[model samples]
Target chain A: MKDNVKLMKGNEAIAMAAIRYGCDGYFGYPITPQSEVLETLEAQMPWETTGMVVLQAESEVASINMVYGGAATGKAVMTSSSSPGVSLMQEGISYLAASELPALIVNVMRGGPGLGTIHPSQSDYFQATKGGGHGDYHLIVLAPSTVQEMADFVSLGFDLAFKYRTPSMILADGVVGQMMEKVVLPEQRPRRTEEEIRRQCPWAVTGKDHGRTKRNIVTSLELDSAVMEKNNERFQRTYREIEKNEVRYEARYTEDADYLVVAFGSIARICMKAIEDARKEGVKVGLIRPITLWPFPYDAIREAAKNVKGILCVEINAGQMIEDVRLAVSDSVPVRHFGRMGGIVPNPNEILDALRRDFIDKPANAKED
Target chain B: MTREEIIRPENKVYSRPRLIDDNYMHYCPGCSHGVVHKLVAEVIEEMGLEEKAIGIAPVGCSVFAYNYIDCDWIEAAHGRAPALATAASRLNPDKVVFTYQGDGDLAAIGSAETIHACTRGENIVIIMINNGIYGMTGGQMSPCTILGAKTATSPYGRRSDLNGFPLKVSNVVALLDGTCYVTRQAVHTVQAVRKAKNALKKAFKNAIEKKGTSFVEVVGTCSSGWKLTPEKSNKWMEENMFVNYPLGDIKDTAAGLEEKTVEVKKS
Candidate 1:
């Protein structure tokens, strides 16, 4: 393996990849499952090498506001936290979206309505895909199923974030965050020069251009109701553009299957194994793993619904993403949800059993012989 | 001298700061925000930081401060201006960063952000307008509202049982090791305005020198909120607000010009 390749946990890969991606600054607070993201950056001392500013903020609220401030200067900045901490950052996220600032936020999911278990759970699917904060806005949410994708999505998320001038999130669960796997890290990309930043983000508040340019004011406060409505219209237009262009998903064995499984993140990795086991038993189950959870593969799921008899949406949460699945499939195919909650990661055997019980054995779901 | 000669350039003694925009200010006729805004513009212009200045505007009556001050400005969520200023200054070391906030913003909602930023010794200037009440919310009680002062929330006189004393935020921050300059000044008189402008100029100089956190609390008045005329508002502040928030410097350690940087250990 090359020097860029190493065996590391997904959280470590996120830190390493951020430095390689030439991130200008990282402001975050410590949280369970994702604390290693900060620990790894501290260990690497990226400031000595790449001049990446890494500071342990006082709280998630302060960290997200720091991100808002840093993003206004047109530099690549980000923050990472677990479910509960992410909840504290919703107001800043809404401001980031409303001001059209480009920044990255990583949510390593854990079970929760309130200080739930630190173990892996996909319960934040609704929060990430739907508007997690107030107002009509969307974050470009990318779900990574493997440690390699964890490293890869740092740059990809930044690209999409800057392209749309909006916030982007890497929605990984605790399993992918803590699990160690071999990964190839990207080569170093130099941070953009101040002049380059000025050219790229002309609307950025990079100080006044003396009198040569109009002073840029970064704010979300519009007292004029009509002007605020126009701002909302512009945001809705950008979201429609994203939905039209950026839907991504991976499908397997759907060409000759009677049952489909909808899943994402690490849960999709588990369902891949379940599909293989169900196929051996002649159940013929396929998998559709959504990579981009926001521009959710609704079209792909709808296409697969035509070939399948019934769909089982397997996740670590209790019936959150299944709503999107049902919305896509509509009445054409019967859709159902099967999962465990409170941090218990369902195994392949249990998922296979769910497939048998929910589709293969259930008379209403089973196709005619 | 003739009237025309008296107004000539050679006879002129004062002019508006060129950095201030031409838009009509939204501040009430007797509000201190307009005067302080002018002083800020003057300081930034005199220091030649207009091009390299980034201002964080807070959510209060001065939330539209960006409209009056012609510089790159970012409007932060209520009380989060210090956290925002920290990142803005750290990422762009050459840029001059400052935050303008009111009592409710600085002492109430953003107290943690203010204390932590000063504790971390972030190199930014924080200009606090301690007006004693929540003027933007129509004279509601604020953390800095004095005892026995009546506000919309405190319809009856504020009692020690129901409300606490005014927060001497500048005095609190002056004791922090991270802060190099902390002062409380007012803008109600000609002498006071000059002293306040001097305090701001020193704070801005400290910020540019990377001395540490520089806090300047201006004891201001809200004529409308206080239900007093502009002249009566100034007199009321002197007799009532001055007893709680006295004018003059509380701490000035910029003479040391010490620069503290925490070194991260490399594994």
Candidate 2:
């Protein structure tokens, strides 16, 4: 109660935080698991108080396009969806990326590969990090594990989005979305002033009209291969800058642990509990929870890997983030993947058992030896 | 400033709009895009909307339309211009927002977006360039491609059973209660160009007045896509396209053409 703290679901926190952080507009469609986001926003009716416009768009395609439109005007706009709905929004996401517009997209992930289940799953980890649509583009991805982070990351994502003039995605799974916890929502931030927007986002098409300044044309269409290549190169440089400056993660017990566990999102929270459980059994286990999936905290993982015997990559999907961990460790230490696929969330005991099997059962070659 | 002193026989009958950029258009000679661009620029310039007009360019042949229209422009993905225009207009109520799209972009791939934008009564102008076939994609059969029309994809000609009926999207949009005006026009002749410009002017004005969605379908000619000369293409459109999509205003809520006022119900 110190800072407007209240019990809330992660999804509801996202909705509340979006409104509190001066989000100009929200466009979304109803989908399993994540439907509470739309419902909460509608129930709150922030338009009456904050002048924040919310529209339940006809489809995911329309909703994301609306974000693309609103972003073109330098407005803090966003859309939320689950796995299948996120799939529908890929084209608009690609367009937003190409146009170099800033937007916040929340994917409260559900089981995938074709509406597999209504329960939580991390199946979209690959789709979110890789270029989901047809283009050479990437979204600034944030993985929020707790209801508090769900509330906190909205502003962080928007700031990073506007900073790079790129779309940002808050990738939270179904468990994180549906689970309730105490969250102290951020203080209300006023919407950007017109003068602030004009100064901050010169490329935004505010219709300051003709001859006022150089016309702002927001488009990714470059017919000339040479020009397109230059644009792509510029984006790559920005990504490299983000990698250098914005790789975020939380490392625990990594200094003295013999085995490191790399995980993200809700699974990371589970892994932290598993690390504690392993510690009770006299197992020196540590966790490297990556908060930013894209521009992933590879350096941190590599740093942690240096002290551990081997790394176990834990996930809710069949080894999606493991690939990134492998790239980070680079065969210097053995990185094994353990995951539960298709909506079944593995418990902390199961994760500790996995560590027991990988380390205790086999006194195998510790990479250091 | 007497007429006798100011008026001279050598005075130009027409001058290019200031908004029309100096860069050459990539469209084929005699393409309807050139005239359409001229008219749009003129409307924005004449109304002094030069400072307040925002345009959306849909993916297709006119994807580069922003290059010619010197204003704040947004290039949307294929078939998503209406959605983009809706956001732009909704957020900037005082600004004139419009989308320039082709038959394939609006009636084919973007039909849902186009229909929904109109149904929501989004205050935006939609200038649809309908040449019946997909022009930029090497003349593929579009949703509005005429029955028995020959295209690259329809070598033997478009069969009714195979391709289905041609869509009159403007007519369908006119039926929506949210739409303020729906008109079909052409620009092959001098008089036709004048009428087409008039239709565009009205559409842009409707957006500024928040009179709901205004759609103007330009019955255009794709000379290269139709495999005909510039003159023959216009003739073909006159004989074929005009019959399916007739010219003139089909609905005009702004002018009180209908007895029913604003029907708030969305389709």
Candidate 3:
């Protein structure tokens, strides 16, 4: 068997992985649950001795715009905050997307309608997957369940962001952000050469040099309606391609199962444990965990629908993911939802009981296999 | 004509353009922005910091100052030049970074950013032009406008009961410990222009030495707002404005012990 990794908190793993991965800048304002990230960077940055810029801005707006400036220079920059801070950053995030700048933002969600308590909650699922800012754009949202995944996703998120020339987000709740678990970091890589960055992002603000072209203008102001429409259409094409190419999901024991569980992030972790317990009790249950929440794992959900008798959507929010599950399963299978709200995390045993009562205890009314 | 009576070649030596080019400036005629830009460019060249210096331009009239100055320039959003300059200086500590901002952009919209950046003691320079009115917006009253000065918004003259008094930005910024240099100067005559240029150069040099944030506010003339010729506007600034906003160093580390008493309180 493979050896388990050393234990670390999710936020600590993110900060370490970001440092090791050659991130040049970390700009953020402190908010609950995500403060560990800045604290860790502050302690570790002096020792690294690299050209790392870590600044605690006055507000979330300033932090995000700082990331904007760093990203405009083709640097690997990131920021993290809770819900209210993230809300303040919507304008800058929209501008970054419009400029097609590569950046990373981590959202450690808390309960909220306005100035909500700083506790673990998945209420931001819709805000993350949907376009959080004005205009037609999307951020590649990665939902991580484990501390190991948290570390791995930081590097992966940067890679995807640079590849797509779009911002990427690691959407995690307070539990995933604060929980401790074993994580193994990836090997470090050299910084990208100036020539390579120029080739990759020719529009970066590198200043005008001799014999070079005039400085490029990075703005989202297109006064002409036709030109604006064309830009929007171009973004749509890119989004469609991303949907086809980057959809990631995991399926466990879906073959000839009577019930399938659909979930993501921390809620998915609990659902997995519930599936294992139900299996021990001879309940034919499986799991479908979506890794990419934006280009959601719709294809996997559709494929699992062929054999499972029913689908149970589990989440920390009330009936949020259920809509997506229904969209994938259509009317072919019966889909039920079990969730908790306002920083309350659903227990694995409770999920297992919901699965048994919904699938194993009920007689087949609309079975597929 | 005799050789002495003819215009000698040596007379053209000092008359040659120090900074401003022969091209027609895009600014409205009599705009003090042209004079201020020339002073900054001359200072940069005099200090031999052209190659290693980066300037940030604000969204007001000075947004296009980069076109006139031959150096690395980054155009920032409205009132965000200071924040941009802060990040740029942090990223390249060895390079000299400065921002050119107007009264509306600096004192009105970006007051928070300006205050925070100064408080952080960022190793950068901020050159603010206080013209008492928004020159770019066709003469709207600004935060630095004099009390009872009439403008587009304050058609009945600014009142103490309604619009409050003029804000002294240099005095406000001088209260931050992070700032190593703070001065309020005016450019109403040739001599005042030279003095203002020297003050700006000193601020830039201080920032380059990694001393701390250095700020210089130049009390400029808005001929268009005052409905006067450029020469008359300069006289108006010298006769009226300089009294309300004096031309001198408000805070500087090298000045003396008395000046250091006004050092900004560190958070």
Which candidate gets the maximum DockQ versus the true structure?
1
Could you tell me which residue pairs clash in candidate 1?
A: none
- Residue-level lDDT of model 2, residues A164-271, one tens digit each, is 888999999999999999999999889887778888988889885434666889998898999999999998888888888888999999999999999888988889
Write the residue-wise lDDT of candidate 2 on B1-267 in tens digits.
Answer: 788866776876867898998988899987999999999999998888988989999888999998988999999988999989888877777788999999999998899999999989999999999998898989999999998889999988889888899999998999887899999999999999999989999998888888889999999999988999999899888898888888999999857765445657897
Candidate ranking (lDDT, best to worst):
1, 2, 3
Per-residue CA lDDT of candidate 1, range B48-141, in tens? Answer: 8878899999999999999989899999999999999999999999999999999999999899999999999899999999989999889999
Better model by DockQ: candidate 1 vs candidate 3: 1
Worst 10 residues of 3 chain A by lDDT: A208-217
Alpha-carbon local distance difference test for all models = 0.93, 0.90, 0.82
TM-score of 1: 0.97
Best candidate (score: TM-score): 1
Query: What does the lDDT read for residue B186 in candidate 2?
Result: 92
Model 3, range A1-369, lDDT digits (tens) per residue?
A: 133355778898888888878787888899998999999999887335656789989888788877876676677889999899999888778878887888999998888868877888887888778888888899999999989888999998999999888999999988999999878876665556556666777776555433454544455555579999998888788788889999988888898677899988888888888888988888878898899998898889989888888899988877777888899989988899898877788899999888877777877673544
- How well is each residue in A203-265 modelled by candidate 1, as lDDT tens digits? 888888635457899999999999999999999999999999989899999899899999999
- Using Cα atoms, each model's DockQ against the true complex is 0.81, 0.67, 0.27
Please give, for residues B1-267, the per-residue lDDT of candidate 3 as tens digits: 887866787665465334444555678777778888888888877997765567877877777786677666766667777777777677666678888999999998888889999989898999999889988788999998888888999998889799988889999988888898899887777888889889989998998799889999999888888778988887878777888789899989766532333657799
In candidate 2, which residue pairs clash? A209-B51, A210-B50, A210-B51
RMSD list, candidates in order:
2.5, 3.2, 4.7
